[model samples]
Target: MAQLAAARQGTHSTKTRAEVSGGGRKPYKQKGTGRARQGSIRAPQFTGGGVVHGPKPRDYSQRTPKKMKAGALRGALSDRAREGRIHVVSELVTGDVPSTKKAMAVISALSLEGKVLLVVGREETTSWLSLRNVPNTHVLSPDQLNTYDVLVSDQVLFTKAALETFTAGAPTGKSVKAVAAESEVEA
Candidate 1:
């Protein structure tokens, strides 16, 4: 997944002499006046000629196994949980419309500092809207959740429904009740 994020593609390219335009006719005949022979203007020896041994586009992405990616996600979750940096709320936003004030209030209430990753369920549009406007807070659907977001955030906040969806798919993981309990104990 991380590799997908950073394919960091190499796009450098230069046309080869054969591919360069205006090179069909020979620049000078083989038995020419005393001057170096040039097959065409596009030949490497000529000015404005094509390059040799130039770089072309390439993919730097590596194939990572599904199990490895899953394990990485689990590891990120476990680290945050161990530190008690995870929080869950019954609801993300109370109002029907987008409200930055309400979103700020939630963060203040949770006393979360630094970058925060708020995982909301698919149906929680208002919650996403309200919170996304707040700086330093990132809103994500449970399906969009990944190890990068989990590891980067100072605190991970999830609505109840989103929490269920996140942990439900993990293997050898804590129950929601246990998660909440563990968070409280550490906090």
Candidate 2:
């Protein structure tokens, strides 16, 4: 199957430019000070040089083509799936809403232990509450998913919505648990 690109929205703006300061005036007077020929105090030589503080503020946001974005997301998901780090779920709904008990039950039912990264399709008050109390369950929306989180844990779980959001670019509409089940070899 064709997969998305491995890049994480890398269509960065090429317009970004660094701002430099200092180096305008001459420092200490030449000739007899017995020291170096002084130029601007901001000459980067004097302790107070122009901008020892570094560049000023600017935008870091990047723009990628729609096709690229979708492709990259798909690729990332596929790579993780191929590595056996991804798990797909039918849904994440629990009878007790977002109860810790319900969350624990799901974990136990699924036999998910250790650090689990749960990628939900959208936000949910219950999933937040339910998973929050769990020791190592990290919950986040599909949009927030990233490589760092993927690499941090041994596995990744995806709700059906999250999977769709990842593979098909769909918006999450309800609460669902997408869990990454850790292996016994690591435990």
Note the residue pairs that clash in candidate 1.
none
lDDT of 1 by residue, 87-152 (tens): 888886786887878878888999999999998998988887787668898999876787888888
lDDT of 1: 0.77
lDDT values for all models: 0.77, 0.57
> What is candidate 2's local distance difference test score?
0.57
Q: Residue 114 CA error for candidate 2 (Å)?
A: 4.9
Steric overlap count per candidate: 0, 15
Supply candidate 2's per-residue lDDT for 139: 85
Clashes of 1: 0
